[model samples]
Target: MSQPLSVPESHPPPALIVVMGVSGSGKSTVGAGIAKAISRPFIDGDDLHPKSNVEKMSKGHPLTDQDRFPWLAIIRSTAERVCAEQAQSGEVNKGDRPAAVVVCSSLKKIYRDILRGQHPASTKMPPEDDTQERHPSGAHIPATAALKTYFIFLDGTEKVILDRMSARKGHFMKAGMLQSQLATLESPEGEEGVARVDIDATPDEVVAAARKAVKDMIGM
Candidate 1:
């Protein structure tokens, strides 16, 4: 951790990077940018949400911890699966960079913890009635159990986020819910492997800052 932040063009081994923030903080955009820059597959957390959750959000309801537990599990599983594939194939396509970038809101610390292979007390629950249960324990990403899991938080102002969300259309998340999302978000300020980048700059600059912070945290 004492090393300088900047690395050469090369990057470290494939780590699970969750480009996390509230709905409109550019998680998907900047996450995709980072993955493209590092040659890893990008998985959007929004796409992983169950239809019930999406419908609820689209109708202006904030999801409960229970609603999010399964979604977080899916994102973590995607990351772990990709990392395992890279390891099995013995591919270093990005010079040690991780094989996947997960783009998700990851609003709460417990959610981030779940993504990092730890179950929070509040989020742990027994299997539901459904056959396709999506709890964290049900869909484990074994490769991530001992790997470096990083959270790249896209910090932004409430005004900025509102504007971005308002401009979008046909998305499950509604602008009216931004306030709740902001309130629910627990910033990854002191968490290890957490990187914060202000969202005031161009996408390229934001990605650059994210990489520098990641390099500093993981010593790339």
Candidate 2:
């Protein structure tokens, strides 16, 4: 696509990590594990969904874009707040780097765009990367280069995903919603700035894959 942005010598220590995938894809579970491995705070995107949306999903009904609008805004705001705070401390000059992992589903590209728009282009660089400069393409945009984000897509076979959904208890989204999630899911093809990994593998394997994917994507 536009010669994918090159990863720096060292990652800017991600400020916001959007662990995205269909329902039952182990996003929360895997997001938490990644946060733990990176030693950053993890925020659950589910918790940001409105109660009405939660109720609809709990009743086996899918939420419409309207239902998700506010939730998405809140999540984006949360990521922005984290970015603003990190920027104030002079840690992220080149990208949107957060102090902790704000775990989010970030289901759609528009959702990602919204979150990235929170911060201005002119911001401080992270502790490690001082050559912080925005890519020419994104100079005028709010999210342009000021935000350093990583999108991790938790992927797996239908059966594996269903099994995980079945085992999950007490979550607002029911197992029945799997079909809807699958229907709505837009796989993170090469266009999106995301790294994909299979969720069918063991937890350790998945985590290892995630780490390696991140390293490879950022050229660590």
**Deviating ranges (above 4 Å) for candidate 2:** 1-14, 50-62, 86-99, 118-145, 166-176
lDDT, model 1, position 209: 90
Off by over 4 Å in 1: 1-14, 50-62, 93-97, 121-144, 163-175
In order, candidate lDDTs are: 0.70, 0.58
User: For residues 9-96, could you state the per-residue lDDT of candidate 2 as single tens digits?
Assistant: 2435444567788876777777777777765557787765555566789999976665655555445544545545445555555554
Clashing pairs in model 1?
A: 12-96, 12-97, 13-96, 14-97, 14-98, 15-98
- Model 1 lowest lDDT segment of ten: 1-10
Give the per-residue Cα lDDT of candidate 2 at 57.
Answer: 97
The lowest-lDDT stretch of 10 consecutive residues in candidate 2 is 125-134
Candidate with best TM-score: 1
lDDT of 1 by residue, 62-173 (tens): 8788988866766666566566566555555546654578888888888888888786656543233221243322243332354468989999998877666666686556
